[model samples]
Target: MTNAPSSLTSAEPVTLSEDEAAQLAEELKQQLRQGQRLAGDTQAIERMVAGLGDKRGLLRLTFAESLGTVGSAAVPALCQAMCDHDNVTVRRAAAKTLTLISDKQALPHLLKALLNDDDPVVQGSAVGAMAVIGADAVDGLLNIIVDPNNTPMQTGLASWGLAFVGARAPQALRDAAKSENALIRTAAIAALGDQIQNQGDEEARQLLLGALKDPDEEVRSEATTLMGKLNDSGWAMPLLIPNLQDSSPLVRKNAALALMKLDDPSAIPELESCMSSEQDASLIPIFRLAINQLGQER
Candidate 1:
């Protein structure tokens, strides 16, 4: 007479206590190290996904790493668990495991979780996975940012994903900069700042220059903020100086801040001039600060 195999070998979901989960995690790691593959083992994969809900944080991380090693073969089960699982802990873990896998095919499922998951941590984990997937995730992320139907939190997550992808895939941001929708253009401009700072992308610099004159106030304001944050006063100073007279007070104020970051003494004359002519009471303090700061830098 033979004893029945453990439930882990069965197709049904199995729950493990902390000690059992720790032992299983070690066994899986050993098997992975010995060149054993779990590629088509649906039973084992499902069990691992369920293990993601283990109460021990370290054990949950172990399960996620083990599942990540399973690679694309693990994506389907992980996606289902992330989207449909009853336990929020399992859903969050599944999304994070997909981030380690970083497979493009998981984008759709990750996007679904990011937009529909009631748990903010799960949504955040889903976006984090999309960001790790890199260039392939750009369009979906940008679409979410421009979609008026999505909530502000959703759009904010998408913006963060774009910034993460920007330096690695700058061409996508350049293409997005020409979008007819000002929202898309503004988001694209904001992401491109990362490209400029990281890669010193000349084309990105040019796009920022054109954005400074954009018809949309938001676009101009975003571009101005990028200029201040760039920390390259030589190039940014000339472009930002004219923006001090922009029709929008926000843009004018941002221009002052960017000039201060440039830290160049030559900008003092320009800052003083803008202050003398400035009419907005709220802006007067900003202009005065920029002039004083630039003077001290000399």
Candidate 2:
């Protein structure tokens, strides 16, 4: 939300008596708690809409949150409020409230706010709201994450949003995995595991198989973890075994742990080999545990 000082700006500030503002704020919160709309009174709705840009941040959020709790009925008004150039705090509050309500009908407005809102906080909140909206948001969120032009921090939040989108994110995630940028690929791989996880999508599985061989160690490690989570015998041994010999110690450790999750006896030999060559005191226990688990299952 915009924090521009009221005294410094030429814009007209919201003029409400202190007692009137508190009563309205409390009324909105009370209505929200009771799961009721703002009395179905046009004047009441207008009053809450006016409160959107309250110079007081707490009051602005309270009003916005209450409007969001009102659900689809307040969506149009919230969208309208997001365009108030004179008060960016109101615009941001509207964007954040859209997320709280999770109405897909607000998708267009939220996207607009995300693309055009100058405030970083508003943009971040819009990203989060889109995630709550699910598959419809995948395409937009992917645009942010897969764009090499975006800074790492921006892509990082996009990745987080995509992860929240979960199984609904697979298609965009598949495309992201093909990005020439290793950072994008690694982030996409990790998000895919978080979202897809053993859901039995062959295309997703194949994409992960490709990730397993990625030159980037992070991608390979994440892919190994996904493979174990899949527990598919066709891949359980082949995909993870070679990782046990990977040059990166972290990759080897993850591979062993994945094998333990897969419980594939065929990996026992590889695990033993890994155990013999492993020098890290901490990783040895994991290798031994994986070996024992595989052995007992046989």
Candidate 3:
């Protein structure tokens, strides 16, 4: 196997002209496609990881993709570069490459970068990698979601990862939904809704309906919003009608919006009754809109 170019190991950010980067990327791709083994070549792996910093966006992406083709063999080096590399570009690219690799062994490094990285792009890429790792990443992501010390952005990223995991491994979400922490419960419920969206999981839909009465308003609100998005008029409309009188205005508003999406036309009398007694003036417009839209549907 040909050695990686010496320039790829430079500590300084690697700046390559577009054509040069393209040629290097093509060479690496050809080598890997030929079944050349990179598994035992630590120096070559690190050098290739460094090449992820190349200035050309497409070439950087190509290098990342090439590293991904190296599979689990490249993960450790990529994780190290993601966490320790001074170049934000390298860090971002390393985390992004890990996404394509989707190795569970990369989860801790990805989680660390997601929680501790200074660059938003690096953090985003790390969370995305964790998402691609799927089921194995769920517990780590749920821990972040429930950690009071995590910033909203950090928790938000973890929640996104959980949603991704839920879509692929909903059993993990079902387990998470039983957590004692309300935050975990809320995130799990939301993720379950996302799973239902993709697969129309009837069990997940039922779980979401149960959440409407959760002691926590945020859980209710999330379930309410998802019920509207489910577009399951026959199944969701009846359960959502009761939420129109929910104590939380957000839940009430969400219920209205969901009923509107259901477009049952039969909801007119219930919506009209809600509008007549609704104390929150802000809900008037929402109720009117739902009524008007449902009227047109008739």
For each candidate, what is the lDDT? 0.85, 0.74, 0.82
> Residue 72 error for model 1, in Å?
0.5
Please provide, for model 3 over 61-85, each residue's C-alpha lDDT reduced to its tens digit, 9 standing for 90 to 100. 7678778777888887887788877
Candidate 1, residue 143: how far the Cα is off, in Å: 1.5
- What ranking of all candidate models by lDDT puts the best one first? 1, 3, 2
Q: Write the per-residue lDDT of candidate 2 for residues 1-298, one digit (tens) a residue.
A: 1121122123433445667878899987887778775664545655676787678878988877767656777776666666444577777787788888888877666666665567777778877888988878766666676666666666677778877786766777777788887866776777776544556666776778888888989888888887787657565678778888887777888999888888668878878987998878778988998888889999
TM-score of decoy 3? 0.87
For candidate 3, the lDDT comes to 0.82
Best by TM-score: 1
Where is model 1 poorest over a 10-residue stretch in terms of lDDT? 1-10
TM-scores of all candidate predictions against the true structure: 0.89, 0.62, 0.87
TM-score of 1: 0.89
Looking at model 2, report the run of 10 residues with the lowest lDDT sum: 1-10
